[model samples]
Target: MSRIEVVAPNLKVRLSGVTSTIIQLVPVQARSLGIATLGPGLPEGLPKMRWWQVPSLLARPATRRMRIWHARRNVEMVAGLLLRWLFRAPMRLVFTSAAQRDHQAFTKWLIRRMDAVIATSARSGSYLDVPHDVVMHGVDLDLFHPPRGREDGFGAAGLSGRFAVGCFGRIRKSKGTDLFVDAMIELLPRFPDWTAVIAGRATPEHLEFAQSLKARIAKAGLSDRIVFLGEVPDIRPWFRRMSLYVAPSRNEGFGLTPLEAMASMTPVVASDAGAYAEMVVPGETGAVVASGDGPGLTAAIERYLADPGLAEAHGRQALAHVRRHFPLSREAEGVAKVYDRLWSAR
Candidate 1:
């Protein structure tokens, strides 16, 4: 076939938000355009180009005047710059910024050289000095849909709990894992039927932090009520098992776990961090509390725990909200428009 017209470089060996985005979006994007990824750590099934194929990019594609190089991280941005400026690749450099924090001098310099820029959320866009388009991340509806029945999820998890409340993602201070644990300790005793589940792993550097939370749970004598499932292979089923989900991150670029949970028919209690405030409709789909405010998080979570019917109603609304506004197809289409505009300009 057809020559590749788009190159999405991951450039990271470890699993991260950027890597996950590439994995989820590439297949949907590939259906519309000639797109392939370049990097390590990605699954073998995804369409990928080897380092040996880098030389081929120096020439224009047969069907297109120039290819698009999409970068989500600093290293990927630097790689795109090297390919276009140093190696004279016939490509247009594009960088997607998910950071809400002010950019460093070096990062600003790197961003200025990009041919096009995309921000994952409006808040993330506000931090950028350069002109950019806002394209929010979306969840895969097929992968994270509602379970057939509540017991279906409970059976899949093999947990002994009438109702489950979960918090997922890396267990770290920044992720606010301790806040979730604290909330569970205080509330689980009141709601004897509810169980708290924490999924995700703590890296070597954060092992002590994770252990401390577990110790806290043991001290509270709620270790059996509050469980930890480290770095699950698939989190969708776990999401379905939850009566409510908590995203207690102190800070985030553009968090997708809330949307994922919402898509899985789980109501969320998220913090103001990331685009959570934008995604969660206060008093509707879910509640949005201030970041790092443990008391506020506890109060918000208690709203759902106190009333299971409210949680189920919100979960239904959340799934509808995500389907209408945050489907993977919408994100793929939005990015495609950016690509189309760049190609049209050429």
Candidate 2:
């Protein structure tokens, strides 16, 4: 078998936030380290190997430095362990946990077998039983950054209003897309300069729910003002077109949209779901409101809408905050450190 080698071998068989994380991290990490993804559904540009290639990939002499099988899900973790035991692969297993709740027995048992565990946020770490590293997720600054002129960006995209408030993600109740629509219906009429945009796909399951939101917008006679542009091919420019971004998820593992908005130099109004409170600096980057509270969402968005200057000022801080604290390179470096320690110990 032809050998494929890498120090960090990422195993992701499913499409999810975990897959997104791997896609985001591997390209950046590959710049400085030997890393490759072993999975399906990752971006085609990423260096990847087939499952059948795992044996020779692990046994090659170039891989003698001791590699890592990084898993982000239970199935991937079990696969990593099996590779080591069943195939005698000389690689350590690492798992990154984003779940904030207590682990089930099977999951806890898997966690015990991992050589290292990484929590995406401090709050996530609190739920772990063993020692773990908190490596907060980061955004690709080059991909998600400020536009030269916000109005021009919006104009080019055919979206109206001088200032746009956007909620970008899956269009469902759990994501609080309905809450965003409610807040916009209440606030959009008062601020003509500010239009609300909801850009996301409503799956077959949530199509009715999404349609209900559209009906509410129409009933309020604000169809033009409250635009639901459904999922776009590129979310970066959509973010740039916005002066303010909102994330009103009822719950999250580690919501990255707020961070993406911040990186794009757009001020945010996110609910206290996920690690949003930790990611967004209240009054600096943007405000974090109570989750599922319509009045609170209204009030927070009102804060930004009422003072355009405050939103602009906070947008500047948002850009700097992301650059200083949450660069994608930094996250890759943190994971590299974990790999380094695992290599040394093994």
Candidate 3:
């Protein structure tokens, strides 16, 4: 078999947020940095190294280059330690922490072993033991941008002549899906021109919860106005069609849906979960309310519905805010700098 070898690079393990970050960052980072993944759940068309190939990878010519084992989980950090200490590989470990709460004993131990650490947001960094750099996640500007044609876009998606306020994410209690639905129920009657679209998948465990919300929407006699799109293959068009996006998550590591919506020039009414407060500018881009406050969410959404012009004005600012502050390229650049520091230290 032909051996696949590269200079100092990144190795991602496990299938979770870390894997998703790798997927989004690899393609862009690869253009200027050497990065690859070694795990399942990652799509094809991106570079990946095999588990069995790790030993061989350690044998390549040094050239003063050191592999960067960029771990986002405890297991991956352990794997990096084994490769460096046991196999004697020339590599340094780096970890990115997005957890908002306190870490367990074992998790802290693993984190202590890393050569460097990265936090997804400033709030996340507050929970870490060691000093770290804050590199907030960003959305793809090309994939998510201002609407080209709002009316035509809505019509293409089978919606018409309506103002859409959307809540997109997994359907579960933690995500505050019910909070959004309840708020919609209270406000939709006041504004006939506005509609609510809930787009996301409900896992088997949450099927009953999701169905209950659907039933409530039906019971309120606004099922037509309040739509539940289980899961969408492409959410970009949905965001483009929306005048306002609502993220009512009770908690989050660092939510990206709001960034995606803002990138699409859709104003947001989000709960102050994750880094949402940092992402949204109150009275400028959108409103941020306390999590689980149904009345607060209802009032915020009603404000946009009461004056469509406000939503439009906020959306324009949202697009500019995202464009100026958060872009996928900027995130990739931040990660690359971390890689450069690790590489140079070796």
Best by lDDT: 1
Better of 1 and 2 by TM-score: 1
lDDT of 3 at 234: 80
lDDT of 2 at 197: 86
| Each candidate structure's count of clashing pairs | 0, 0, 0
Ranking by TM-score, best first? 1, 2, 3
lDDT of each: 0.92, 0.85, 0.82
Q: Write the per-residue lDDT of candidate 1 for residues 213-303, one digit (tens) a residue.
A: 9999999999888999998887778999999999999989899999999998999999999889989998889999999999999999999
Q: Candidate 2, residues 75-105: lDDT per residue as tens digits? A: 8888888888888887788999999789999
Evaluation by lDDT, superior candidate among 2 and 3 = 2
Judge candidate 1 against the unseen true structure and give its global Cα lDDT, from 0 to 1: 0.92
**Best by TM-score, which number?**
1
Candidate 1: clashing pairs of residues: none
Cα TM-score per model: 0.98, 0.94, 0.93
RMSD of 2: 2.0
User: In candidate 3, which residue pairs clash?
Assistant: none
